[model samples]
Target: MITGELKNKIDALWDMFAAGGLVNPLEVIEQITYLMFIRDLDDTDNVRAKESVMLGIPYQSIGDYKERPNMIGMYKTALPKDVAEKMRELLQWYSKQEKNLTTLAEFHVRYEIIHPFQDGNGRTGRMILFREALKSADVDPFIIQDDNRSSYIEGLKEYREEQKTDKLVSLMQQETVDYYQQCSYFME
Candidate 1:
């Protein structure tokens, strides 16, 4: 919740990125990585802004939220300006959705789109999705693994682009079946 003069300064920095046509998330990260390399090679290491304090929570903002401008393929995540409000809306909406595959997929999709955290958005969202699955009746929890990564991205892209969840729901269905089979095997 950075505000006042500090927020303005942060906004100015983002504006500079926009002015330089660095809208792509990967490009921005690349530029920042170079800056980090240069900083590592230099002796000017005492000038970091003291505003942010890391609390060892990957899914949360530090002292205040910062945007990393994340993207998945062509889809840019929620805008930096809308993070707080959108996150509020997401939580509110999350509290009321029907706890099933449709809602679960939709919830995961929306969370990925919102992408509130600077880092760990995907992992955090998947964790929440799995938890939500546990809460739902008859929906065995399953992790979104690297093996299903393409389908996961495709599902997200479909919903983001076309307002559809069939692919996502299908993926969840298969994952749950797999989870149940594994559980049965272990029990046997």
Candidate 2:
């Protein structure tokens, strides 16, 4: 039941996955489930909220010299020994910042850079995003699409290298609105 450009794109996707040793197609589905991250915002201290994202994970550090990769392997992560301090710094920074989209954007980028959790960094980081969205309006996850995928990465990189979060905040705000508009009708 598939053909044309869409099929081509799917084929390319399969090729990419195949190159990465992902033979089981179900793995793609599982990864997609992982992408369904983030949650609603609350007034409580979100520090623990983000920390609790990775249950049974360390608060201090993980290994003798652990360093995790970004989804795209953009740059190195915080040194293993520095994970605790870096996380503390990120939390302190988060506490002082406003509980809004901009702060959420920067906090997420910083959290990803820290790579606090041993294996669930993205899952945990994604949680912080939805919590903020939940605070103001309905939960609106970034709609999974080809464009959003690339834009999301660009937003992260912009934050990391240039220390600019405007692009990311804008993207999230728009994604919030788009997600609501596209999906809210089904709820009604």
Candidate 3:
């Protein structure tokens, strides 16, 4: 069950994303992905800090975003050094982009590859994607039925292996276009 506090946090996050001027579903999701990554890192560091006597990693060893040029260092606290560097590069590349539909799509492609969340990454990413879609594209989020899960995962796999984003992007585009058309028809 969703607690009231958690519900409020989600609502507040959506509002913050909207205020940040990221209306594209992909852009919003990407922004949220970064924030979530930072939050998770802080949480993990807090846990590690309590056990610092054994881990030998001080809580204060965690890099502050204000001191660092990028968050690659923060995420590194949890990820392998090499993986963290790669994700940091991707995040920096994407974060510098201006808000646009193309950037939104690119964000979706890159963030999925980073896969920063230990769990709930896919679901949370999709939620941001949906909200951004509603705000920017006027498209409602469509559910991917259980049977289609394999295809979705396969598309993401191709992206990671080959850097090809066509399959997933096309699927999202088609779903959004289809939903918009259906809604338009109903209104007519």
Question: CA shift at 131, candidate 1, in angstroms?
Answer: 0.7
Per-residue lDDT over 12-75 for candidate 1, one digit per residue giving the tens place of the 0 to 100 score: 8767888999875434544554565456433222222222334333333322444557776678
What is candidate 2's lDDT per residue for 1-188, written digit by digit as tens? Answer: 67899989978877887898876644543344445442211222255446766686544332222454334375777766788898889889888876777778888889888786555565556655765555444434543344686777788889888999988777887886776676554244
- Clashes counted in candidate 1 amount to 0
RMSD of each: 18.9, 13.9, 9.7
lDDT to native, each model: 0.71, 0.65, 0.57
For candidate 1, give the lDDT of residue 69.
72
Residue 150 Cα positional deviation in candidate 2, in Å, after optimal superposition? 1.1
- The superposed Cα distance between candidate 2 and the true structure at residue 175, in angstroms, equals 0.9
lDDT of model 1 at position 94: 76
- Per-residue CA lDDT of model 3 for 63-179, tens digit only, reads 432222223212322343344676688779866876444455567656655555543446545655655554554444543434566666766666666777677666676666665
TM-score of each: 0.63, 0.56, 0.45
TM-score of 3: 0.45
Quote the positional error of residue 6 for candidate 2 in Å: 28
**Candidate 2, run of 10 with poorest lDDT:** 36-45
Distance from true location, Cα of 34 in model 2, Å: 11
Q: Candidate 1, 69: how far from true, in Å?
A: 2.4
